[model samples]
Target: MMTIERLREEINKIDEEILSLLNSRASCARQIGELKQKNSLVTYHPAREKEIYRQLLATNHGPLSYDTICAIYTEIISACRGIESPLKIAYLGPEATFTHMAARRKFGSSVEFVPVASIADVFAEVEKKRADYGVVPIENSTEGVITHTLDMFIESNLTICAEILLEISQCLLSNSSLEEIRLVYSHSHAFAQVRGWLKSNLPTTKCIEVSSTAEASRRAAMEQDSAAVGSELAAQVYHLNIMAKGIEDRVDNYTRFLIIGHSMVGRSENDKTSIMFSVKDRVGALHSMLSPFNKHNVNLTKIESRPSKDTIWEYIFFIDMNGHIEDDNVKEAIDELRESCLYLKVLGSYPVAG
Candidate 1:
């Protein structure tokens, strides 16, 4: 009983309304950008960005899924943010690496992505301001912490602006058939992730380490009888066939990446604070440092200790707690901690990964 012309007419009207509303939003964003510029403020605000997503998700009632809604807004924000200033980001790369994927997930496809060779390089790019920000892998749910990233934090003055949690699924990519894969190539981390699968299926294949998964794909694409363990993005980039998908030993693998920048993120509704400090090498010393977090009623989400690299057995502890650095209880707790620690550094306070 419904007329197609009537439906088409309604859709046309809706399209005009959508365009008008988008322009209005862009105008407002540009005005905000002018104010930020006048105030000498950084154009990219991860805390405000997180709040935008949170508010949108809370209001969304859909035929569209949560991911779909997020994707729509990500590009919209990215485009409008570009009008204020286009962001240039560095990531651990040859391109198509998980860190690269995480960077894209946060900033969207509208901005520039620069691929650097090492975790240190990623840090350097942000520190030198060659790149506005950088994304580096910090830890994997499967293989544990990236010590290099942790080490970089010890020296680099950059703050952790945000964190990204990516669900990692590797693919076996090759130009030839399974029978032809005589050698396996992957980053050392990637090999660790899918070691059991390689041992079970291609035990006879000689495995080699590369700088990154993307680098492995590059080698595999050129070398005969070689396959790469990498993201599906790598397969597409190199025009290689994905002989097997989700080839990792563990299916539930996840990796956490950190966004590093010169400026720290402001407080968000839900936040996590990370800090590093060294305590006297004595009994109950570590306990004395952590006591304030308990006294302040803060929940400690993560804690890690790395050797100070200056003296034997001397170490600095890194703690991530639930709450912003600006929060009264968190500030009181950290100040209390300062008395016990020989040296203290607030690494960052950012919105917790949703």
Candidate 2:
């Protein structure tokens, strides 16, 4: 058996080799980026990324799981992206928000991060090309949907390139002694999700609404008599003590985030397509819009409506289906829906998460 010193030496050699290879890979990527730029092509190619991950997973030998390998490669790719130009990613922020965490998980630490004030800002950044991509929350298992994000999607031309599901754990943070806490601050959604827990544990504490959980954390960090209900990451970001952890009423809480970019991605075997459409204002109009999916045997994963800002009492329906737009059945269904709708837009077709 090798001694500890020998193992350390081997690790150092491997590290040096990895670094050398990475530099070579980055050089190639830079050349590729230059060529793409000459042709006026987009930087992020979701289809290529999906293919790379699929091939890597197929050839993977254990010791590291497929997910672990994919994660490492994602970081490596993000670093190589700088050879083209550092990708600017916008997220709902004030740092340590779940959207920030999702951005990090998806793009790694190499991309330049922009902390935007609202979901609309996130969409606008990508739409205006100020950022290469933007990350925004779309839905939560417990709270249903982020209506603001969906509303923005209906009006934007941006495409969904990827999706990430993050497990949420709401923590109670305070600078005060637990017994001295008289109020708790958090976003309204977080409060609603944890209402039962708050009522049972801190009935006397007043629940205050803030712009965001990160903001709530900041408030709790400053006020000795107050607590903030937020993520564990928010506590660390704001330098507050955790008075309680996992305070959300639901243990299975998870939020789904969408990665939006300027162009549509190529198709993948495991892909999902998102679209928005407005139906005619008549009885069974909505039913007519959905019948095509049933006829074409397309699996509808989600459907939600938001009031159209363009017209009063008129609404836009956002639909998520479990196949790429390139699929024959999906194409047929889209054609049929388009015929029935006043306006329709196929947002994007992108790879599904493993």
Candidate 3:
């Protein structure tokens, strides 16, 4: 057995080695960034990132899980981001919003954050090249799909580069006593999600809708008799008291966020592909579109429809499936799907989290 003194000396040496290697890596990344800038190449290369993580995980040995390895590399990449330019990420916000939280969780606080008033604006910022990426809520386990985000996917040219799943916990925030509160405020979705809880706890309080949960928290902070049903982050940011905690109607509530950018990335061993398509207005059109997946043995995870903004009664179907677009089976399925649908677009194929 090694002595404690010897172990301490070994650990110090390891720490010094890690610091030296990281410094060298950062210098090399800076040089690469300069070359990319000279070639006018964009900094957010999702495909390259996926490839790097895939190779890293493949070579990983015992003592660390795949997620731990990926997380360490994520920070390495984030630190190298400044070698090009501080990545500007757009999110639906006034700051302290869940979207903002997701963005920070994914990219870290080093990247510059641009909070927009609406989801549409977040997409627009990415499309217009004002931001490197946009983070937006795609779906919630309790409340179903966020239709606006799905519609934007159908309408925009953005690709889903990465995804983040956030476990949601909401609280009732106020400045006054629970009995003194006569009104509650929250975004419509948040209210809908916690309707059951509200009925049980504050049945008599009048519910008011606001632009965003952050706004609701702001209103709650300003009005003594009003409370906001929002994330705990909101309460902390707005300096409000938590009247009640864990107030969500369901404990398993989680929201999935999508990172949207300009291009599709290469696939990983574990990946999920998203596509938007419109079936012909004929019998079996939808079935024919999906038949390819069955034939190819591709797993279809989700399918949702939205009204096609261009025409009345026409609809666009969004699909999420296991496997990356580069897989032979996935590519074949897309080819067959294209033949069946009037229109089809592969939104993106990105690595699924471990």
lDDT of 2 by residue, 200-315 (tens): 98999999999899999999888879999998888788999888888889999999999999888888779999999998789889998899999999999999999988889899
lDDT for model 3 comes to: 0.87
Which candidate comes out best when scored by TM-score? Answer: 1
| Candidate 3 lDDT over residue span 1-354, tens digit each | 999999999999999999999889889889888898999887777657768877887898958988788778878888887766779999999877889888876886668999999999999999999998999999999889999999888779898998888888888999999889999999888898789999988889999998888899999999879999888889899999988888888888899999999877766668899999997677777887788999999999999999987878788999999999889999999998898678999999987843
Clashes of each: 0, 0, 0
- Over 49-154, each residue of candidate 1 has an lDDT whose tens digit, in order, gives 9989989889999989889999899889998998888899999998898888898889998899999988988988888889999999988998898888888888
Q: What TM-score does structure 3 among the candidates reach? A: 0.86
Off by over 4 Å in 2: 310-312
Give the Cα lDDT of each candidate: 0.90, 0.90, 0.87
Candidate 2 has which clashing residue pairs, if any?
none
Q: Rank the candidates by TM-score, best first.
A: 1, 2, 3
Any idea what lDDT model 1 has? 0.90
By summed lDDT, the worst window of 10 consecutive residues in model 2 runs over 41-50
After TM-score superposition, what is the CA distance of residue 83 in candidate 1 from its true location, in Å? 0.7
**Position 273, candidate 2: lDDT:** 95
